[model samples]
Target: MTSATNPATEELTPFPDHTQLPDSDGTFVKNWQEHPQSILLTDSITPILKQLHPEGEYCIGQDLGIYWRLTDPPEKGAEAPDWFYVGNVPPLLDGLTRRSYVLWREFIAPTIVLEFVSGDGTEERDKTPWKGKFWVYEQVIHPAFYGIYEVQKASVEVYELIGGQYQLLSPNERGHYPIPPMGVELGIWQGEYQNTDLPWLRWWDLPGNLLLTGEERAEQERQRAEQEHQRAEQERQRAERLTAQLRALGVEPEA
Candidate 1:
């Protein structure tokens, strides 16, 4: 495709924007866990992301269409990952919420892309030319990290783009795949989230500390406050007992 700008008049040529892209293919094959999984991952890692992109120049796409190529159906040339993160892009495009991510308009690719596999998971790993999701990600879209998560098996596979090819990454000592740029590790955690008890995909810090969601952090703070209050009460009780003992011994207690 030629440049959107014409050098002759320096006028911008006609190009499709996010509004022009189709967001979905009208198919609903996602399981119940997919939506909550996306939220879980988003909520927990949001604090870290805010710190990383303090200026608020980052966007996350959850099951949103990323148009890499223009096709007849418009959705045919797109690959919508379960979740994706792209830094240095505004959450909104020119004060308008993005209907879809159009690569031709905004030349920025996502930093990481993840796919949640609901079946045998062959499609997520497919590498067929132009037709496979994996091939499109590795060759066309080319995110730095691509992850395939299978909740049924409680396993996740992460791939890194190295030397223009996707290389399977080995988990670190913490049994988590390291996403160095984000300074976090991706792994499965056995826990209950959104009222469902199962192994959910989660993120961990570089030192293997689990990143807490906003709700979890709030609960931790509440527990700490209660402990502090209990300690204060215990100290007050001890002081009162000492005062009474002093009075009983016929010594005047100091005010």
Candidate 2:
């Protein structure tokens, strides 16, 4: 029998490994509709970043906490970043909302973090006691960049971890920074998403320019087509006028 028709090859069945099984934790995340705009911003930027950095390992999402029990005993305090990332590490943490992102276990802390303020009037709380929280990320976590997106204020700010402290990375005219961790500068702007035009977080290049979404790109193409049509119409009208002038001069304009 030819190798192409080998029965052994056809009968091969893949077996599931029980020893290296996936995490089946039922840790719950309330539907993300609480802040619809933030959801769009997160959904839009993350997949692209992951796709671009296929070789690098990372995870970005909410309600999933990182458990930092790798070195110290599993700790009670777990911080859930709106969107957090750890480079060059497996994306799953015990298959559940991480108890705390223990750096030692994963051999790396999150490279960048994004915080979307829900505007529950806890700005002061976040600025003070929570200041220490981000401080931990700055001092201990040592993320290269930390972003705070304020939906109500339409403000986006990024803090770069510098010299064991958090230094605000000033935004250019467009309000963004070129962070190398994710290879994309995060920006805040007003745009259409889910049929609504409002403030949203956008990914940009190092040059501080907005990257267009598929929908936005399509809209631009439509606008360009309309402009081209108008220009052609204008040219046609001019040609007709010239033809009428030739007819009046008895030049007998051809059809």
Candidate 3:
């Protein structure tokens, strides 16, 4: 997607002046695994979307601060989801670093927001008005889909916005919640990712195929190449044996 630019000066304008906007206040501190998990989830999802819609555009945030002024004091109305995705928006605005995602400037709320429940359980499910993450997402940001993944329980709870309120979604037979708009399912996978052995929240296609990371895709390609090489070598050896047998029988095989 093309970044926002000033037509008058022909200069790149990523975002409006952020000084007037209330950015992050550091209310929530991230755990060690939180960042990695967020990265894993976003990284795995983006490539699939790109492949499916080559002309599509998307913006993904991993613990990136999101700013919104829903109250009289703008400072009090900002909340950042662990991982969020907004479609039809530039991945980066004017190739500049984003201080925070300003909803007014972007003019679009994230399509999906995912929160990884921290060990302390500070604010993952907070529903207090204006201050809680749940309240902010449901009332203010109003993402189409909201998901909370608890690593301890190895469970995922997905909520879909219906009639302006978030309703808990039911999982399918494979225990995955289908996100129809995205054509993907959200679920927990018990496996190792980035050398960490744990239950990781991941994405799957509607047909129950797991969305693979870049590393996993590369590994699969390598294995396929190796198999092809072995097959070619076996065929070559078989042909050579047949030629040798023909020569021994005093009938030279044609090249």
Candidate 4:
């Protein structure tokens, strides 16, 4: 959270309200094998970001179309990234659910956009200017960072927008790319998440701590409480042994 401060606190030109924006009408199609991974990525990252900014001033979207521009007759030009995060935007607009993320209305593009390579792999890396996912993200949406995760290969590629062009980012010694602005790193993790066993893309803090999901957090707390309980029980047993020895010696042990 050091460098990834809320943008809402900055002074900028007033943007249009959510009511004035056109809906992107993005629909999510379920891919039993791949869709769940996207959910796991979002689920893992959202809570960590929320904890960093407790004001509820961030938006983490999954498969929601990001409307980057307005066209003639008010066409919705949006491409839905598997997962995206925009810091400093309201989690909801005017207390209403967001149908799509409109860039013009929000006045801020997403800080990071992630696409999990599908089995076929045609769409995630498409480079056709107007219709390509890569083109739209690089030219129109212009996120600060873009990541592509290949589940099968267990590899990830991250690109940083340098001088309005995406430059390939090299991984550190730990095979993770550090996203300095967000105070996190992107890396591939091999394990079970959400009851599904697969290699999934995950986030880590600067100190190399894996961000935990709600379930994982609960499990950790449970372990700590159990450890404390065991320690207390051991102390009680030791005291009882000492009291018994004192009573055997005819010395009245105070309760």
Candidate 5:
């Protein structure tokens, strides 16, 4: 639903300083209502999550705070990416825990950045609230791929940062972008993720096949095994019938 209560955070400011931020045991869902987009987009990436990190070593949601501080006193700095995926970093931030992803310390940049465009008036023309985010991610964070998905409508725009500039990445005929780093493609499919099938992002194999979720994969395996078992049983029955016919003909079957 929403943020889980942390007993450690007493008299909590809606926004806590980096140093004062409480330590979490790597649960990104905490305080999610305060930041719903983080959960929504992260959920959108579920099929690709394990494929991105089968070992669960390198990934961070918005709550981890891997964003540039844009505001004086850094109020705007809290504009975390909806969901960002980093490659090849320790699963945990420090040897202990991390409050926000500090660029200076980690020396790591997310390979992909996703933004959910809430229906704000100015977002249409790349105005104030939205432009600031783009500038920061492009100039400051410089994430390789930046994507924006609108919820109230059906539209997804992805950007690729190349040669010190952000360029609009066009989708193929089927509206999917091949992400070489993740070894798959991402697209806006009208399928379910987190029980809501509202244009979720899905991952595909190199041959452009949809990647299966853990549940879907298990179901596939079970179905395949059942098919194989049935085929083997049929073969055994055929062999027995043939052996019986040969013996009846007085031609002893050689096992």
Candidate 6:
């Protein structure tokens, strides 16, 4: 872990907690799609994460910072992934919402980090040491998987950390990147979400089933119930017709 130094004394003081860090850099989101994109990724994976961490020992950060070093201006040392997931850790620190992930205090690196490309994606792919996002995640944070999703191209590039370096992963037969840690795959789906029709990044199970959001799952259940009701109505009408046929043949139908 990189250490922070106080410029005044040239010595290390106690590292600041999440409370002391600047949560935001006062930078506006690059585009309108960023928020919805982040939400789509998070919403679809909530059920999978709950099943993975049944005791609620997990954290999901959407557009939140992971503080790796203590810099003069704290936000400079942090890289806020568009979306990230960490397991085996409490969702909240001391029963409070996490302002940001402080690495020194919480030693768990995220299981996966995803960056949504709003620009030409040079920043996400940049490999300059101590500065670039790719270099930091590969060397400092070292998540199991890192994904770059580009909406403009309707494509995603996933990398798996192997032997201390990120290996660009190839999609499987289903055209999705498999993440074994969570037994799920990452891929893009052309769909309408939040009233926006776009290619949204989503998750799938190992069996090639798309993970549905809460609303999607609800809609599925509603459709299933309607189908069952229709089947029952058809059965009732068939039984009534059979009774009428028996009456015409001069045989009373049993009650």
Model with the higher TM-score, candidate 2 or 3: 3
Stretches off by above 4 angstroms in model 4 are: 1-30, 33-35, 70-76, 246-255
- List model 4 lDDT by residue over 34-68, tens digit each: 56777667777776777777998888887776877
lDDT for 20 in candidate 3 is 57
Model 4, position 56, has a per-residue lDDT of: 82
Best by lDDT: 6
Scored by lDDT, model 2 comes in at: 0.62
lDDT tens string, model 6, 1-255?
987876987766888999889889999988789888888778888888889999989999988999999897889999999999999998888888999999999999999999999899999999999999999999999899999999999999999999999999999999999999999999999999999899999999999999998899999999999999999999999999999999999999889
Q: lDDT for every model?
A: 0.92, 0.62, 0.82, 0.81, 0.66, 0.93
- Writing each residue's lDDT as its tens digit, candidate 2 over 112-203 gives 77777665425412434423456556655567778877767888778887877778887766567777756677777676677777677778
- State which candidate has the highest TM-score: 6
Candidate 1 segments exceeding 4 Å error: 1-13
RMSD of 5: 10.5
lDDT of 1 by residue, 1-255 (tens): 886866788776677888877888999957889999999999999999999999999999998999988799889989999999999998898799988889988898888999999888999999999999999999999899999999999999999999889999998888899998898999999999988899999999999999999999999999999999999999999999999999999988879
Candidate 6 off by > 4 Å: 1-12
RMSD of 3: 8.2
TM-score of each: 0.93, 0.61, 0.83, 0.81, 0.69, 0.94
Candidate 3 lDDT trough over 10 residues, lowest sum: 13-22
Runs off by more than 4 Å, candidate 5 = 1-57, 70-75, 120-131, 151-154, 193-198, 247-252
TM-score of 1: 0.93
Question: Judged by lDDT against the true structure, how good is candidate 6?
Answer: 0.93
Residue 168 in candidate 5, Cα distance off native in Å: 1.0
